[model samples]
Target: MRLFNTNTARAGVAVIRAGSLDRSDELDVPVHAWVKRKQPWLVLPKDAEMFEDASTMEVLFKLFAR
Candidate 1:
């Protein structure tokens, strides 16, 4: 097994602080479906620009910034 070092852990914290990573499982299909069922009025943004594999830092920033 492997373990993370201080710098590695710090880097991860920095990324979270910068809002570059999505820690919530909100975008997960099952979770999304459940939330939608619970709150039918709630809506999620949809766009042709949606992608499966990659996204820009600005997108990630907007998504995780809260």
Candidate 2:
């Protein structure tokens, strides 16, 4: 999942993988609430490895800048 914190040219992106999370993961309640609120704007790709390459991430960043 890619969570974009902003929709403007200087948007910040965070990448989260399903495998990287577990039930025991300790995320703050407010932060989790924020993520839930931002869920609609998140990019959830079917293929988890799609953005594993640096080039792909760079391309996405450039696209966001535009």
Candidate 3:
């Protein structure tokens, strides 16, 4: 299995820290649904702008609506 080193892991953490929402923030499912594409799990900004880091589960749920 591929392993993530500290630097990469920390980078992911930085993304979350830069996000606009908190753990308790309720996300709008339909809005997220609009962004989920067949080829990609979720759509990003025009440039695939970095979002404040979210958990894998959080990101997946938003994309898949599970």
Q: Write the per-residue lDDT of candidate 2 for residues 1-66, one digit (tens) a residue.
A: 532334344346654543456753464221122233344677643433332323244555554576
User: lDDT per residue, candidate 1, 1-66, as tens digits?
Assistant: 222223442234322221233554444421121232334574555533454433455554555665
Return the lDDT, model 3, position 54: 28
Model 3: per-residue Cα lDDT over 1-66, one tens digit each: 222223464343332221344642454332222233234565544544233432354564454555
Off by over 4 Å in 3: 1-55
Clashing pairs in 3: 15-52, 15-53, 16-52, 16-53, 19-52
Clash number by candidate, in order: 0, 0, 5
TM-score of each: 0.26, 0.20, 0.19
RMSD of 3: 12.6
Candidate 1 global TM-score? 0.26
> Residue 15 of model 2: what lDDT?
41
Q: Give Cα distance to truth, residue 11, candidate 1, Å.
A: 6.7
- lDDT: the better of candidates 2 and 3: 2
Query: Which stretch of 10 consecutive residues in model 3 shows the poorest summed lDDT?
Result: 29-38
Rank candidates by lDDT, best first.
2, 1, 3
RMSD of each: 11.2, 13.6, 12.6
lDDT of 3: 0.38
